[model samples]
Target: MIARARLIGVVGFLIAGATGLISSTQTWLLVSLSDGAAEPLAVAGASAVVLLAPLSLTALALGAALSIVGRILRPVFGVIGAVLGIALAILTAPIAIQAPVSAVSAEVAAVTGIRGESAIAELVAGITATTWPAITLVAAVLMAAAGIWVLATARLWPEGGRRYQSERAERRRSGGPLDAIDSWDDLSRGGDPTT
Candidate 1:
């Protein structure tokens, strides 16, 4: 049951990470100009001000990898990842609720290349909507849930054989050429190795 849970968590983390990464490139806000045309602005997930998308994605990836290895430190990493995810969600929610005026204004000015007191600038200041940020928030929540699951089930997870095995022991066991042979064979007809 623990193994199953861990597997589910790993899959969730991976999916969340991928979703966050993809959404980061999408437009977060739409700025409407004076001409009644909507201009897609910067992505919330990739915004420098938020800085949550990449961080959350990276944490989810690390958590998934650690969970797969079944190491003793998996729980620690998982908790850290979870906390990061939660932080991402918390930070992004407000941004999605209302677009930052200063940032949007600067972006609009840069994009439309219209100076102050211009009709376009006024339109840009008044036009802002939350779209992509909501998606990022959802991804962050998923990642956080996955990390928490991993943390809870990591101790019950099965240890990987390679993780505990020593390199010297493996080398010593395969010291001879016959170690590579699966079974001995005779050149006699109608001979059965098992018999």
Candidate 2:
């Protein structure tokens, strides 16, 4: 069961990661294609916002979905969520790191006609444009946090499952006569709830 969950999670993460990169790349390319029709600064600002928006949203949506899904499964859900979250994070990091670097570099080149000038400051400005960096950071943080929640939820997986398995086994091992006697046995038996 855990193996199945792990497989499903890996497959889902791969699908999401691959599609996300391709789609995001396409959109950013579209933004770049807006070259001659508009002012460079507006184009830069607008495109930066556009590129960062969905990455942040995707991260957020993944986190929420993972948490909800984790709660439903109550165990393997965490492992699944964590695996998917980390895989997607690794897949998406290049683009997240790229946006500010690329856009700011482009604008800086367009404005100052220079290669690299105060790259750090430009990263800050571009990242802050429309507060997209904050949004992105929040989303990434949430994804990791949700993964942790899921991982923690699985701590009882072994013990609880083992207890249930033992009771079921004891019942299964009892004969047909015992099966017939089971209701009477329960009625006659008295024991501590703590056990």
Candidate 3:
């Protein structure tokens, strides 16, 4: 059913967004000192946001929006979200490969309390030896796949239920004894329940 597809799509986007959020906080760069003490350059999701905000934030917002909007608009947003995910993946590839030498060096210098050109060079070398960029790439791929799934199946989603309807509409229909009570209350307040 379309409703089921819509639910699945919503869940997919949510999972993708959650993954991206988690990936941002993960350690993207690691620095090992000469003494064999390994330290993280940036350990929070906030640091990753500096480099991946464009992609991560967009996916989060789109996923949240998809849950509220009607079925007809789901696919359109899905495609847009998918494109953003791909862009994120593309942008992340190089950072993952090269390890952002300068940034990592600066972070290492700050963390290790090292203050010499040679020391910085050694730290940079140590930092670059590790691989963390793959995290972002994986997150990006998940987001893209979720978006694609939504785009592919949105057309089959069912219409929203009465809960999505306006409050006024709920008062208009004559149901059981409760319906008369509701209409009477609306009329007493000088409000047209039918409207």
Q: Report the number of the highest-lDDT candidate.
A: 3
Question: Residue 153 CA error for candidate 2 (Å)?
Answer: 4.5
TM-score of each candidate? 0.67, 0.33, 0.64
lDDT of 3 by residue, 58-172 (tens): 7778888887788678888889878877887876776677655554555556677877666677755455422446766777887788789889987776665656444446544
All candidates: CA RMSD (Å)? 8.0, 12.3, 5.2
The better candidate by TM-score, 1 or 3, is: 1
TM-score of 1: 0.67
Greater TM-score among 1 and 2 belongs to 1
Mark the regions of model 2 whose C-alpha exceeds 4 Å error after superposition. Answer: 1-37, 40-103, 106-128, 150-153, 157-168, 176-195
With a 3 Å backbone cut-off (N, CA, C), the pairs that clash in candidate 2 are 78-150
Between prediction 2 and prediction 3, the one with superior TM-score is: 3
lDDT string, candidate 2, 13-99, tens digits: 334433443443332311222223343243332244344335434544553454334334645545554554565455445445555
- Candidate 1, residues 50-134, lDDT tens digits: the string is 4655675686567557755646677876787688779878777776777655435556666667656454446653545556677
Q: Which of the numbered candidates is closest to the native, going by highest TM-score?
A: 1
Evaluated against the true structure, the overall lDDT of model 3 is 0.67
